[model samples]
Structure formats: C-alpha cells, structure tokens
Target: MATVAATKPAETPDEQTLREDLAAAYRLVAHFGWDELIFTHLSVRIPGPDHQFLINPLGLLFEEITASSLVKIDLQGRPVGDNTQPVNPAGFVIHSAVHAAREDAQCVMHLHTVAGTAVAAQRDGLLPLSQNALLGWDDLAYHDYEGLAVETGEKERLVADLGTHNLMILRNHGLLTVGATVADAFVRLFILQRACEMQVAAQAGGADLIHQSDAMGHKVAAQGRAAFAAGAGLSWAALRRKLDRLDPGYRA
Candidate 1:
C-alpha cells in the first residue's frame, strides 16, 4: 500500500481568510481553464468542531465567485444559516465525503478538465510518463466511476478509494485532491492536472513512451513531498498575487 507524507498543520486561518483563499482558488481554476461551466467544486473546512465548510454558490461561474458570496454549509451539505444560495448536489456528495472522513483534509478540490477526465477514462490510469506524474505517482488513488455523484451512498466508497492519498483520479470521472490548507490542495491538483495533460499529449503522438523505474519514481515523489511541505504557502501567496493583478474582486 502507498502512503502520503503527512503534513504538519499550520496556524488555522480565520473564516474570512479561508473564504478569501477558496475564492482565489475558484478564480485560479477559471484562469487556468479548469472550470467545467461551474459543474465542479472546491471547498475548505471551517475550523472548530461544527464540521462546517464553505462552497461556491450554484449557478455562478468560477470567475464570478467572491469570498463573501461563498456559502457556509454543514457536513450533510445543507446551508448552516439563512443563506439560501443554491449548492451543487454532486459537489456536496464528493466534497463532504472527504471533509467528513479525513481530519487532515481541511480543503478539497474536484475538477472536470479535458485532460484529467480523459486520463481517468483510461484503464491504466496516470502513467509515470512525466516529471509531474512522478511527483504524485505513489500518492495517487482512483475511485471507479459510479455515474453522477448525487447519491449519498457513494460517500463510503469515495472515502475508501481516496484512503490516505491526497491526489486521486476518479476513474471515468475527473480529478480530486485534498490538503491541510487550500494551497496544499490546489498545488496538488495543479500537479495532477499537468500530469494528465502531459500523458494525453504523449499518448496522442502514438510513440513509445518511456517509463521511469519505480525506484526513481519514489525518489522524485519524496522530493515533491518535501518541496510541498516546505513551500505550499509560498506558492499560494504567489498565486494570490497573480490573482490580484488579474482580478482582485475574489477577495471582496
């Protein structure tokens, strides 16, 4: 069985900070062309024992999501307050499963990108075909597709498939990633998505692809874990600056 390097918890950001960070993530997803017409979801768990989290309001594009516009919801995916913003049912099923089951997974991100879904459709899953793939090679997990994720029973299977890994390719569905913070999850999804893109491009060429040795792959995976453990916040800060230049409305 594979294991992910455990991440030490950083000081918990207040609810406002988490909202801003998640809002920034939604914008970044759109900025990178990862949004699927607002079909996918990104969520961050709020601190305290209430098990509440924030998600994008339904019917809004990723670019249009702002910190104040996010909706706070409970583990059952129901809104916690008088906020009546529509929530995505599928998003609730997928994200609530992770947030409820994993204490380490403070933030969860799921996406339906062309390359990610294409790779998920393959029987072989993500190959160690690129440095990006190798970065998450050992940490990757897969959940067999069970049609649309609106069914609540699928939560058990989803958590089982995800196990301890932070990076997952939902077989025949899309990609899912979790982290101790929004930055951790987003950085992981970025790596996993890039790997899928590289795999798709390489396979399209119809040429023999080089496979790295398991020993070397492990080495690279360890290097990646260390880099993320050290710099996820730094990467996310830089990304936030980029978002600031692009459209700072997400912080509103």
Candidate 2:
C-alpha cells in the first residue's frame, strides 16, 4: 500500500484551530489569485510530540476549503487519524522537509503566482530593486529547480538548499515561505510576491533600475520590523473580517 494516504482524524481543538487558520490562508490565496488550481499548498503544523500537520484536501478549490474540510497528515504526507482525503505529494515533499528541520517553521506556504514565477525564472532572481524586497533582506535563499519535486531524494537536497532561510525562491519555479505563525507566512509571501511584481514591471519599462546598498537595506528592514509584525497580524484580521462579510464558509 502507498504511504501518503489516510488513517483517521482526531479533530482535537488545537488541531481544529490550525485547520481554520490554514483554511483561511487558502481562501485568501484564492481570493488574490495566488492559488494555482489545487497545485500549491499552505500547511500549518499541529502542536504535539508527533510532527503532524494540517493541509487542504487535494481536489478542493482553495475557496472551498473549510476548517473541517482540511486533511490531517503526518510528515510523510499520509493522513492521520480517520481522514479520507488524499494528500498532495508535492506539499509533502516540500513542506515536510522544512518541518522536520526547522522548529521555527510552524506554517509553510508554497505559491505559484505569476509574478513570483516570472522573477524566479530570471537568472538574477529577486533583485533588490524595490522596498518590498527589503522585507526579506538578508533572509532569503534560493534552490535550483529539480523538475516536479516528486522523489523522496529531492527532499534532502531541497531542505539543504533552504537551510535557515524563511523565504526561498525556487529557481525556475515559484516562491516559498515559512513562518512561526500563519499570519507571518502570509505576510512574507505577500511582500515577496509584491517585490516580484514590482521587479517584473520595472524591468518591462526598460528603465535603469536603482537598488539600495545592502547596508541601507538592512537598516530599513530593522526599522520596519515592529510595524511589519503589527501590520501582518492587523491586516490578517481585517482580511478575515472581509472574508466573513463576503463568505464566511471557510470558518466551517
């Protein structure tokens, strides 16, 4: 039998909270066109001795994801407890690698937005051309792409490539980010994608780009940390309120 399928689901309170937050992330990503049909994944680790986590079901649209609709899975991406939903091999391959290695990465988000992919395919990769890029200054990594990310062997190489970085630009692929919280991951992805969009747009104009010195970048990042932290949590709540106004079904 294959390993990445289900056992059952316990659906405890803490796990349930993780489910809602992850589902909220899926909904936000879909609302912003950051979702690629059901290809990419956003997962949050469940609190326990075991390294289990919550991920969206493989076939569901991001907008269709609900708290109870999420699948609980192990590090291998197999369903835990009584879940029947199938897990995405790609999600397991990438997310489990980081979760196993980084205690800081409680939430992992992988996205395939147009801007992120466009910038990633560039040889230089995420030029420090915009203030948005400063959000991840001195805190980014790059991993050379290795096809569709299916083999278990690729997991080790990918995690090694990721190292201690919270944000990674997968060469010729897309953007990846991990955070201690769902809000943090979402904000990092938001800033990275915005940076990519600005870079691609600026380059399209064929204008001479001006980049800040690394020292200036570091200084600006440090200055922005407090506001960035507050804004991420604040904007997340605002967006959740917007979601509730539009369609609160994700909170199910």
Candidate 3:
C-alpha cells in the first residue's frame, strides 16, 4: 500500500470512457473465471500525457468492481485517492514495466486462471497446437518466475523479455497481455487462455501433437487481427452490450 502524491482534480469525457472500459474488462475477466481472488490486475492508461492509470481497488473482487470503484494511480504504483484499500505492489511491478516501456500498451491484463498457470509450468510453453495458439505464434514472450513480481529491479528484465511482444507467459506464474485498447487486450487474453487450455487438454491425452507451420501460424494471427479490426471490431460498445445483457451494474 504505497501512497501517491496528490494532484489537482481534473475531469473529461475521455477519462470517463477510460474508466468505463477498464471496469468492463474487470467484469469480463471475472466472468471468464480468470480472476485470482482479488489478486490479479487489469490496468488502462488514462487519456492524458501524464503516466496515470486505473486499476481495481485491492479489496474488491473483479466481479464486484464498478467504474466509480476503480482506483487511479501514478506510474510508481501509488494510490491517488482517499480510498483505504491496499493496492497490490506486485501488480504495479508488472504493469508499470509495460506501461513505461511499451507506448502501445494502453491496456495491460494479468491473470492467474487455472489453464494459464498450467501452461506456464510446462517446459515447452505455448505450443502451436491449435488455431488459438496461432493467434500468439512467435510473438509471445516468456519470463522466468521471480516470486511475486514485487521487486522494482525485476522491471528491466521483464521488459527485456517482453521485448515488443503483447503476450507474455510468466514461467511458473501466470499470463499477461497488453493492447492498444481494452477490447484488444481482452480478445488477446481470450485467445491466449484458450490456447493454454487446448495445450493442457491435448497433453493430458498423452498423444502426438499436431503443430501448425510457422508461416501458417503467422498468417492466422494476421487474419485474426484483421478480422477483429473490421467493422466495430470488438469495440467497447459490444462488450458493454454483453455486460448489459448479463450484469449491467459495472457502470455503477
């Protein structure tokens, strides 16, 4: 629970949208059972030049989160409000690294879902065994586990390993994905988690694996991205619609 220096209050429509999108992502992650008992974090950059971001209050479960309940913090992982809930220091370590180094990482998602962690523990990492795996292809990064990721010193190494990749598998830990938008990050996680599950299940059967060629994998990933960018293309509007149909209270 580090405290951030207070700054003058500022408000805008873009900030509001950022807050709403971040909240929607939390709810969606919870819906998919990717949350880890209020531990895992999903963060989005505020619509400003300042290195500000929004994350869930530490005490609240992902499903219980609402836009108003989300906490704002600086790059140093300090809470910006009067709220008393402790922020996860380790999450700051992981998120700040990406936010600081990768300008395109507008949204950073980390999860401890069963399938994700199970895949991380495997020696071969994410196998190109299925179409879902191809979405990641050779673009995925891997980082060796270093306890709970609480050390500031780990940031450099983490960034080095992540090096221009959006998907990262924290070996023996969990998974991380970054995106230019909340929708993109969510879709990436969805595909990454699916790939992990497929790999685990395929291995469980102890049968020979059917791997995709590198060129085909890259092509599939390119096509998937193109398909996503088509039309409204996984826009926050669509996600909001899904939330409204299921649990509309995330805007509260």
Top candidate on lDDT is: 1
- Pairing residues by index, what is the TM-score of model 2? 0.93
Q: Tell me the tens digit of each residue's lDDT in model 1 across 1-252.
A: 111121122235598889889999999999999998868999999989999998988888898888777888899777775556778999999999999999999999999999999999999999988999999978999999899999999999999989999999999889999999999999999989999999999999999989988888899999888888768889899999999998898886
In model 3, state the lDDT of residue 180. 87
lDDT of 3 by residue, 1-252 (tens): 223232233367787777778888898888878888879999998866788888877777888887777778889877776543567888788888899999999999999889999999989888889998997786699999889789899999999999998899999999999988887788788889999999899999998888888899889888776676542344557878989899887776
TM-score, candidate number 1: 0.93
Q: What is the lDDT of residue 142 in candidate 3?
A: 97
Instruction: List runs of model 1 lying over 4 Å from the truth.
Output: 1-13
Candidate number with the higher lDDT (2 or 3): 2
**lDDT of model 3 at residue 232?**
31
Q: Write the per-residue lDDT of candidate 2 for residues 59-124, one digit (tens) a residue.
A: 878888887777878887777766668878888889898898899999999988999999999998
Score candidate 3 by TM-score against the native.
0.91
TM-score of each: 0.93, 0.93, 0.91
Winner on lDDT between 1 and 2 is 1
Q: List candidate 2 stretches off by more than 4 Å.
A: 1-10
Which lDDT values do the candidates have, in the order given? 0.89, 0.85, 0.83
